[model samples]
Structure formats: C-alpha cells, structure tokens
Target: MSDEDIAPGSDVEQEVLDDEPKSILLGIIGQLRKGGDLSRVTLPTFVLEPRSMTERITDFMSHPELINNAPLNTDPVGRFADVVAYFLSGWHIKPKGVKKPYNPVLGEFFRCRWDFEDGSTAYYVCEQVSHHPPVSVYFYANPQNDIWISGHVRPASKFLGNSAATLMRGTHHVQFKRSWPGEEYTVTLPNVYARGILFGSMYLELGDSVVLKCPKNDLVADIDFQTKGFFTGVYNGVKGRIKRESSGEVIYNIAGKWTDSIQFTKASTSEKKTVFNAATAQIHTKVPPAEDAQEEFEARKLWERVTKGITTKNLDYATKEKTAIEDNQRVILKERAAKGVTWQPRFFTGPVDDDWSFGLKE
Candidate 1:
C-alpha cells in the first residue's frame, strides 16, 4: 500500500502544492543557507497539517492498548519489551507528506481523553511552555490502569542542502503507578529528517538513535532508525538490541521496518516473535471536548478558523487567520513586557534545570 493509504485523513490533497505555494517555497528556499535554523522561518499555510504541535504530540498515545496492560506483566523484561513496542507504534501515524503542525503559541494547551473498550479512560494534557526554542510539555494518565507518562519536546529545525531535520531533544518518563510505582523508564527521541525537500519526491524519515532505559531494571534498548540513502538503502528500517546495563549483555535483538512490522529475537534461545505490526494495529481515537466548549487558549479552539480554512482548501483565508493568531500572541507578549509581568504556561512549569514538566501531577 502507498503511504497515503495508511495515513489517516489521507483523502485530503496534502502532498502536492499549488503553483503559488511552490513559488513561495522556492523563494524561501533561495534565501535559506545550508544548516540555517528554521525556527523563525514562516512557512506557507499549505505545508501545515491542520493541527497544533501541542495536540500533535498526542500521536504517541494513539496505540494506548499496547501499554494499558503493561504493568500487569510481572517480568521486567516482558514489561520493557512492551514499552518498546508502544514507543515504536507512534511513528507510523504521520501525515502523507512533508508537513509540519502549527508552532503553538506560548501558553497554548490541548486536552483530550481516550475511552478504552474496557471502560477505563486515559487523560492527556499538553501545553506550549516556551515559544522561542519551542518546548512543549505534556502529561498522560490512566489512573485506573496505573499508567502515566510525562515528557517535554524541544524540536530544533535546520535546513540541509536537500533536506531539513528536526532534532528532537526531549525525555519521556513512563511509570506504572500501581505495578512499580516509582520505577520510571526514561525514553529519548529520534531526529526527524525530511528528505528531498529541494528536489525529488519529498518524504519524511526518522533517523539517529532512540534510547529507552530503566535504571532500576538495568535494561536499555538502543534502537536506531535508519534513513534511506540517496541511491540505496530501504526506508523505515530499524535495528536495535536490548542489553543489560551492568554487564552489557545482549538480551534481545530487534530488527524490522517501523512502518510495517518490528520483531524481536531472544538472544539466548534465538526465538523470534513479532512485537508490533503497524498495518494490523488499530489506532484508538482521542476525544477532545467540542470546540465551542474549549477554552480560548485550547489548541482546537485557538486554531479553529485556520484549521477550517486548511481543511476546506482555502489557503488564503487560512494564511490570514494564522497570521492573526500569531500577531495576537505578539501583542500579548508585548503587553506583558510593558507591565513588567512574565507570561506563564497554564498547564506546565519549569525548564528550571532545562526540564519543562506538567504542573498538575497526581
């Protein structure tokens, strides 16, 4: 199947840009230097996915079932493998092309809830804690199932000659509230590369290494997301090994294409089994409250007009609405500065030691 066949909302024309947008992009490309920071770049509305980054972060929770029962596993190795499966499941849910979500304004937030078949519910809240460097902090909780996750992401974008890369700098803290209360498993992110941005068919790829570690269990999974080379190499390939931290003994060997299936083989017995199959997995829906019911700063409510314009193929209106929101944010920041006041995030705190955290932790 094609990438569009698997991507949700693929019916929308996302991959191809109009003549006007193409010219705009070409102009921007001409001005950008190789290795230039893209944080301040104003991309056209056509390249934006109809959502804010604050809400987009919830993609990681799409396959909540993969982790709902993780705490029930008594074996630490079994639990760790489940975490790996959950982490790898999120990458396949991207849009059909090289599109980026709206850069959320400071203090903007998104909240949603997932209702599982078993009647248990998971709640998630995400906030844009910083705007300059673009740090987003989020928290997820399924108290009834004893699962909790809190993390922050600071994406740093850079322009390569023919590609663009977003260095995902962040940490995810996953914990089982009931099974192993204080035992936290830390997970790092893989950098995202948008290849062929200046020439061939533009496509997104996750590259570099992702480290998932549990110090208490002395286990670490070093997964490498391999990017396709210009003339060779397969897309979406991933390879890794789970090892004991103390002695550096390999426990399980992991290999496969993340967009298709990931399998793990036992180190000693050589027994192989499929861990995650993206094609067959069902992505659960997250239900955010109705837009009319959301607060002014909520992601969906804040970008409602812009999202509506994008979805309806009205790029000019979308650009106008998007610019209005950004201009309003500037006005708010200037007002705060004039009053000698600080703009604080409504749902998150810190960067105290370079760590932004959810403020309301239960």
Candidate 2:
C-alpha cells in the first residue's frame, strides 16, 4: 500500500498522512478477506484501543449508582426490574468499529474505581487468567452499597463474512445487600457481532440471547438482542420479559435499545417506567496515567510504548513495541514451563464458579 492507493486530496489521504497507522488498515482488511484468524494474527497497532481487555470489561460497572439504587424499588419484582435496567445501561459503551483491542497477555491485570454522583464509589479489578482460550476474570464492588459483580468469560473470535464476531461464554453474578442477601442474580454476557468489514461504514451489536435470573427467587429475565439484518431489522433492538421460575408468570416486559433506555411495564397494571435512560446517565471513562500507574501491572504502563506509537501515528514504533511485549511474554512462559513452574492468577485463584457467589454470604 502506498500514498497513491490512499486516494489523494481526500479524507483518507489526509487522515493517512496525519497518521500512518491509518494506512496499514488496508493490510488488515486484506488479511481478513483471506480468512486470517484474528486470534493468531498480528493486528496493526494503530487501530489499538490503548487499553487492556481487563480495563475494557469494566465498562459493565461504569454505572454503579444504578445498582446502589436497587433497594429503592422496595418490591422484589420491582427491584429485579431495576436490576435489568442497570444491566442494559452499559451495552452500548463502545462504538462499532473494525478496530480490535489487543489480546491480553497472561496474568495481565487492571484495577480502577469510579466516584458516583451520590458520593458512592465503585471499584473494579480484572485479571487475564488464561491466554490460549483468552479468559478474563473481573470483579466490581461498591462496599458502601454492598454490591458486587464477579465473572470469568472466555471469548472466542471468528470471521463471519463481513463481520468479526466474538462469543462471550461465562456468567457474572450480581449480589445486592439487604435482609435478603441470600438470593443472588446471575447474568450472562451476550455475543458481540460487529459488521462493516468490506465497506467503510461499520456498526456493532450485542447479538443472540442473554438472561438474568435468581435461583432463590426463581425469577428470570429473558432478553433477546436483535441484530440488524443485511438491510432490515433494528440496530439495537432489545426485548425481553421478567417471568416467574415456577409458573412462568410474566411480571414485567422490558423493551428498548440497550444504548438508550429500557422500559419495564408491569404485567398487572401495564404501568410503564423507564428505569435506565443513558442520555442523562453518568458514565466513568477515566484511568490512571502511565506515569502514575505501577511499573507493569497497570495497562497504561504495560502498553505505554504501543499507546505512544498509535498516538504519535508511528506505526513502526507501535508494531515494534507491541511485538516486543508479546515476545517477552512468550519467552517468559517458555522459561517457566522448562523450569516446571506454573503460573497462577493473582486475584482469581480458585474455580471461577466460586466467583458467582464469591464474596456473598449464604
């Protein structure tokens, strides 16, 4: 690829000349056309998000106040209705794009916290527990509210024609405080389907089905994420209903785009209330700067060079640093294996299933 191929005098050329990594994107597209495996492929660093996967998954906990306000509803069904709203709040956190986040190296970790509007705090920690299957374990908690989120998910990526799809296979548990801490809500992640590979206009969606349920309460929230068809279907159409476990008595119907607001209509009175409105919602997107971050554990510090490369539009530097970091990890793993040593996750050491109710009291 050359400047001539970049279409002179257009935004493409201007963007490319301003940032060279914008140029290697053509190469990435070419590789994708040949059905190159994204997991094993070396992605151009310019398209990097400049953050670790650990940090990225914290998008779920960005709206901690929603969880803190769960008790306000008073009724079990109403509270779960609010919980479903809280779950949908963070669906559209990142915009649709072909750009992908760097696969986390083994033992990579991220920790951060958010200061909410009501003066409450939500802290989070994530660990890259496995590399081959690409598993990430995350924990988020607001001690003041006694709410916590814990889960481990292994993401599998594949090339599906014009899109790169990733399936999230793991369930996260949500525990809220009250006299009834015994009942925990279990939530599973939805599949991520991102399109617009061949064309320039790209979009992202959470596809397939996702459910939120409490075993003790026997209440289930069935959510179906509607992905847009080739030309039809809504982009972010999310529709579901909260129903009983035994009789399957539908309590409330949920409908709305995950990026916008989700409404809960009580089955008895048809009373509708918008529990989550993203337009007015406050989202936290700050992280520790590289200088202030610890030497290696922090994402900003670990990928500082790669970030600099992309920010400065130095593709060569970005690729070099990214490769060096990846290579160093490989060598370390090899040496450890030769020495008959095993690597363990710092934050998540036991079975991930334990995380579902890890800190919750029985």
Candidate 3:
C-alpha cells in the first residue's frame, strides 16, 4: 500500500466484514486458549490493515513539528514537555475497529522521507529485524532541525477470553543532535488491547502506563492511558503528571482524551492550556517512492499483490496472495538453515544486548 492509502482521511476506517464468516472466525478462536501467543497463528485476511508493521511505525513520526523547536527551548522542563506532547500525538492516528498490520517477514524494510514546508526534510527507515517473536526497529532523523529518534517495538500478543492484548515492549530515545548532544529523553509505549475479539463489536484500546524520562534534565512524565472498563470509565482517557525526578515534585497536571485534546495544568499557578488537539493538529504528509521504484524486499513491493486484492474487495484473492508470500518465506528460511547461514537485516543491526540500532551513520 502507498503512503496515501493509510494517510489521514483515507477510507481505512470503513470496516470490511464481507470476507470474514462467523463460523470461520469462531473455529479459529476455538483452537486458541486464553493467554495463548498469537505470533505464529494465521489470521483472517479481513482483519489486516493492508500495510506492514514496519510502515506502521511511521505513524509516530507523523507530527515531527511537535518537537521541532525542542532544541531551542532554554528551559529543560519545557523541552521535556515538548517530548511528552510529541509522544501523545501519534496515538490518535489509527484505523477504526480492531485491525492488525501485516507481520513483516525477516529483513523486510520500508523507507520514506518527509519534506517540511521550510525546505527541511526528515527521513525514516525501518526493518523487520526478527521474525519469531516479531521485532521491528526504526530510525528517524531531521538533520537540519538536529532531531533524531531511534526505537524498536516488540509486540507480544495474548488471547484473553473475549479480548486480545499486545504487550508492547521497547524504548524510543529522542535526542537533539547538535544541542544537548548527550542528553536524551527515553520513552516507553502503552500496551494495546483489542476488545470483543470473540463476540460483540471488536474495537481497539491502549491501556497501562508510559513514562518519558530524561536523566540529564532530571525531569519525567508519568502518563496512564486509561481504558474503559465494564460500564465504567471512558475510552482514550489519559492522565498524568510532569514532575522533578529529584524531588518528586509535580510541576504540571496532564488531563485529556488522546483521541481528542490534551491539556496541561501548572501546579503552582493553576493555569490550564491545551497542549495538543487531535481535531486540529495537522498530520504532516509523508512521501514514499512509487511501488515500482522500491526494492524487491521493500514492504509495499513484497505485499503488492495482497494489497491490491484487499483494496479491490477481492479478499479471497488477498488470502491466496498472502499465503503465497508466507509459504515462500518458509522455503527461504529452510534453505538458509540448510546452508548454515543467518538472515541479516539491511537497515538495522543487533539484538546487541537485546537491542537493535540503525546500522548506518546518522
């Protein structure tokens, strides 16, 4: 799928259930037990979002403008707040209902660039570094703005009766290359829960807590993404506190819905102001080269037939194409095993102490 296919205002939210039969879905669920891992399970094509997980990581980079001026902020606390705003900005860009992106094959990569209005540009590259316990590693940089972000996401999914939860484990390190070169803001991700997978209307929610901390600045934000409980609470509610790490003194109170607007209130002055409003926030455009221009192992090129089948409402064809790709991967893996060769990623390197890094120099 092209970048525009998944961009904001696309028809990605329109649920297509015509290809998924209830009995088939139930049969698949019958084989799955509570707390079972879904990493190896083959799911229905209709539940796919028509994109690879490697490409999905770009969603977090969609609002680079949020942190563009962070390096220029003299106050350390102000810079910390900018990082928090950028982290919370991406959660609102998602397809409606519960859908998962394609499980990228090992070594599969996606690359794109974002050109800002000021003539500056940012580049993003990601790779499926591991297949068995799927891990995706990515790097994004805006050299002109002295902004750099590198991260990896390992999604471990579990079946929880009527719901499926993806325990997101990873860290994103944001740094200002030129200014405060050694100082970094470390960020964590919220766990994703897909509710009503077995019955009722299936929907997605993010729960648990996320911490954004900077050791050099001694500032931190403890944010909790609250999910709706049975007949209680509300969807997409987020509340947190920005504080001084050394004294544990709260500086600002953060409250708002991630899918809408987020407001921050200063503890000392009781001054409240909206920090990010999803309703009005402009999602900067991302430019990806045409499919024909991509390499053979690039995400869009590898899944072209499958994506075409999905977008054209020919799901049966999509399933056939998807199966062919997976089956071909198995053959390649077996061949590699016979040759005693290991598959290496193109854009990333490691599990170096269980962490991956962008192989190329920034």
1-362 per-residue lDDT for model 2 (tens digits) = 22243333322111221234434555565667444456766776655666678778877876766678775556787668767877888866773344567788988877777776677777787778788978888888777776777888878877776677888888688877563578689898889865654444455667898999988878999999987664565657788999998899999888887877778888999999887887888887545445765757566678878878877878689889999999999899999999999987777666744453233223
Error of 2 at 342 (Å): 0.5
What Cα-based lDDT does every candidate model obtain?
0.87, 0.73, 0.86
User: What is the per-residue lDDT of model 3 for residues 104-200, given as tens digits with 9 covering 90 to 100?
Assistant: 9988989999999867899999988888889999999999988999999999999898788999998789999799878999999999997766656
TM-score of 2: 0.85
The weakest ten consecutive residues by lDDT in model 1 span 5-14
Report the Cα lDDT for residue 301, model 3.
94
- TM-score on alpha carbons, each prediction: 0.94, 0.85, 0.93
Better of 1 and 3 by lDDT: 1
Task: Return whichever of 1 and 2 wins on TM-score.
Answer: 1
Which prediction has the highest lDDT against the true structure?
Answer: 1
In candidate 1, what are the lDDT values of residues 164-239, reduced to their tens digit? 8999998888999778976789999999887666654567888998899999999999999987664555678889
